[model samples]
Target: MTVALWCILIAIFLPYLCTGVAKVSGGYRLKDNHDPRGFLDSLEGLGKRANAAQLNSFEVTPAFAAAVIVAHLAGNAELVTINVLSVLFITSRLLYIIFYLADLATLRSLMWFVGMGLIVSFFVVSV
Candidate 1:
């Protein structure tokens, strides 16, 4: 698939990765309860951050996917623009996860902003 399409695939699965970390941390505890709030409340530090990242990933995915589709339909087919934003969004999200797990709030917030900017920039390129 094209880079843009691959990005859509990545967007689809990123949340799962974050959740996996959370679950792996919780182990049998989460496996038993499996209640969203309970499982989330049980986490601390890096696990909590993983859960937050999972939620945030869910929140951001739709717009990012939509933007990819829009840019695809816009017929510019400017793979360079699409690919750059794709990489930026993915990289920022990875860094966001790392920073969040490390409890570096400031850097995490910056990465969040950068991810948002990259998301917004996709719309810009679509136009």
Candidate 2:
């Protein structure tokens, strides 16, 4: 598969990665499985930040996926361009998560904008 397509797959699972971090760090147990949302909601500090990042990841993933797919189907942009943007988006997300965990709100917000801009770039490149 193309790198951009692979990025779509990665984007789909990124939220799970964030949630996993939250669960592992939040002291989530088997009992918590019955009320996972509640357990997640109770998290504080890094766990809470991770959970928030997970939610944000889920929120942006669809648009990122759609942008990549639309870019591919349009077949107007160079493959390298699409792949680079996809990689950059993933990088931005990773940085965003790191910043969130570190409680660096400004940097995290900047990375979020970067990711969104990359998503928009995909559509622009397809045009």
Candidate 3:
């Protein structure tokens, strides 16, 4: 398999990774029953970020897959570059989720932009 395929696989597993993080953190139980709201809120926050990462992965993976197939079909020499970008994009998105869950808005947004830029670049190059 190509690097792009590996990156896609990693992206596919990102949501599971987020869930693992949540389980390790608290297993969905917040605190006392009196403060159930707080626990639920924290879980909600993590779930939102995990959903965001999954959405990003969904957005980029298809394009990366297409690029990989097309590159192989057309004998394009830039497949490695595209695959590298795919890896970088997924890695940045994983970090983005962690930072987002930690409430690091600026850094998360920056990482988001980087990931989106990679997707856009892939689309542009593929066309």
Candidate whose lDDT is highest: 2
Per-residue lDDT of candidate 1, residues 1-127 (tens digit): 6787798889889888988888777663535665766777688877788899999989988888888888878877488889888878888888988888788999999999998888788777767
Off by over 4 Å in 1: 29-37
Clashing pairs in model 3, backbone N/Cα/C closer than 3 A: none
lDDT of 3 by residue, 70-95 (tens): 65565544787777777887788778
Arranged by lDDT with the best first, the candidates are 2, 1, 3
Candidate 1: count the clashes.
0
Worst 10 residues of 3 by lDDT: 23-32
State the displacement of the C-alpha of residue 40, model 1, in Å, after optimal TM-score superposition.
2.5
> How much lDDT does each candidate structure score?
0.83, 0.94, 0.67
TM-score of each: 0.88, 0.97, 0.66
Predictions ranked by TM-score, top down? 2, 1, 3
lDDT for each residue of candidate 2 in 17-42, tens digit (9 for 90 to 100): 99999999998888879999999999
Task: Give the Å shift of residue 3 in candidate 2.
Answer: 0.4
Q: List the residue pairs that clash in candidate 1.
A: none
